[model samples]
Target: MNSVMITGCSSGFGLETARFFFEKGWHVIATMRKPDNSLFPTSDRLSILELDVTDQNSIDRAVREAGPIDVLINNAGIGYMSPFENTSDEIVHKLFDTNTFGTFNMVRAVVPQMRGRKAGTIINLSSSTTLKPLTFMSTYTASKAAVTAYTECLALELAPLGIRTVLIIPGLSPSTSFGKNAGDKISKSGEPADEYKALMEKVQSEFQREMLVQELTKPEDVVNAIWQAVTDSNCPVCLPAGPDAVALSQ
Candidate 1:
């Protein structure tokens, strides 16, 4: 039986992906910062584990407990939004800690085992914003952009080792908790600068308008793309998950 370990299985893409793989009969190691087995269906193939990607010890322990795995999904991440000048050092560090360094830690933990086995797949979740930068999202875009670039290089390096590295870039998904979580962070960061306040308002209005008219992608589409990344041996290093992403890629 093939086993897959996924991070951030508490909600959104991670939760849906966990359910998808579990239903498909793969041993699903669903991991989150806090493990709750009730969120997933009762299946012998599903095991929930607590993992904090920012903590190397936590990542190391989770990888050890997960045992041999056929796939690793680095899906745990946090998003932040604010004018670059308004973004604090603390917020900047926090964003990179979760979105960039966290991914690096997870990859470092699993690579040894995957390398030894000479067979495995690593799928990373990145944002479509990396294709076209958005105002007030420079920091978040940079973080995910780093993941995209890292996966590209890693794909070439790992291919010879029989390990596949795939990136799933999903477009804006308001259906997920990502928007709410990012909003919560922005709220905690206080208000925007007076100079940028008007610009921010205009950007937000335009963004909302575009969202209403645009064919936004769903979380399921992302999960499906991820499934393809896992099972398709010939899958490209970068798999854009939604119509918006596909459009941007072109």
Candidate 2:
């Protein structure tokens, strides 16, 4: 049976992907920052481990523990909300650390093993926002854009080695905690926003309308894309998941 490793498996796309792969007979190594704090229901084929993607030692340990993985799903990410002028260096760096740098660290840790096997796939969880930018989310959009560009480069570079890199761009999924968590994080950041509060709130509301109220997509949408990326022999290099994604791709 094929075995896969997915980061940020505690929730959202990561958790759904792990469960989907497990049900499909793939041994899934689900790595979260806190294994014990997993919110997803447990399973026998799912092996949970603590893996902070920003830390090299954590990546090394998880890589070693996962053994031979046929696919690596880099799904860990954090979000931020602020206008370009209001975003602090600290918040911007935090978003990059988890979304961009974390993804790079995971790729670096797994690429060597994939190279040895000469057969593996890397699926990056990118954002549909890369197609269109919204206000107050410049930093978050930029981070996903970075991932999209990096994955495009990796697809070509790793192809000769018999490895594939696929970009799984997800639109908005309402059944996930992504929006709630993002709102909470921004609320806690305590950024000074007297005039921008209305604008930020408007942006946040629109994000919710698209992602949650409309139910534009579900976790299963992403799981299906991920399955196709890892198992389908003729899958495209970049697959967008969800209805919004399909519309955007057009």
Candidate 3:
């Protein structure tokens, strides 16, 4: 049975992708910051592991324990939403650490094994905001944009090695916890205060109305995109998930 190792399976896209692969009869190594058996059904084909993508040692240890994986999905990431000026330096570092360098660390840890075996698929989750800019999401967009660019370069570099690099650009997803998490992070950082408060509110309200007109991307849409990225050898280097993403791609 082909095995896949996924990071950030605690929730959101990572959790859904883990279940999707397991249902397809693939051995799944689901890595989260905190492993919770209750989150998924018990199966011999499923193994829950603890991993912190921002930590190189954690990534290396998880990859070593996973043995040889046919696929690696870099889905563990954090989001920040605030004016670039209001976004603290610490927030920038933290966001990049998880969303950008975290991906880099995971790739570094697993690519050696994939290279030795001469085959593998690596999928990185990015955001559609990278395609069409969004207000107050500059830092988050920049981080995901980095992932998109890195994956493109990686695909070219790994082509001769028989490895595939895919980037999944998903649109705004209300079903995911990402927005809530981002809001919480912004609150903790005390953003949108003083001069930026009114502008932030206006932008957020406008964005919400825009979302209503555009079809929101579902979890299933993302899952299907990921499946295509993994199984379809002819899939494009960048696969857009959901209507907004498709629109942005065009």
| TM-score of each prediction | 0.95, 0.91, 0.95
lDDT per residue for candidate 1 within 1-250, as digits (tens), equals 9999999888989999999998888999999987887898777788899998888899888889889989999998887668988778778877888888999889888989899999999998899989989998998899999999999999999999989999999998877776454543334666767999999899989988988999988988899999999888988889999889989998
Model 3 agreement with the true structure over 20-78: per-residue lDDT tens digits: 99999999999988799999998889999999887788887888888889999999888
Could you give candidate 2's per-residue lDDT for residues 4-108 as a string of tens digits? 999988778888788788778888898988785345456666688899887899999989988888899999887666677777777777788888999999999
lDDT of 3 at 162: 87
Candidate 1 off by > 4 Å: 182-187
lDDT of 3 at 92: 87
Worst 10 residues of 1 by lDDT: 179-188
lDDT values, one for every candidate: 0.88, 0.83, 0.89
Candidates by lDDT, descending order: 3, 1, 2
Q: Which 10 consecutive residues of model 3 have the lowest summed lDDT? A: 179-188
The lDDT leader among the candidates is 3
- What TM-score does model 2 achieve against the real structure? 0.91
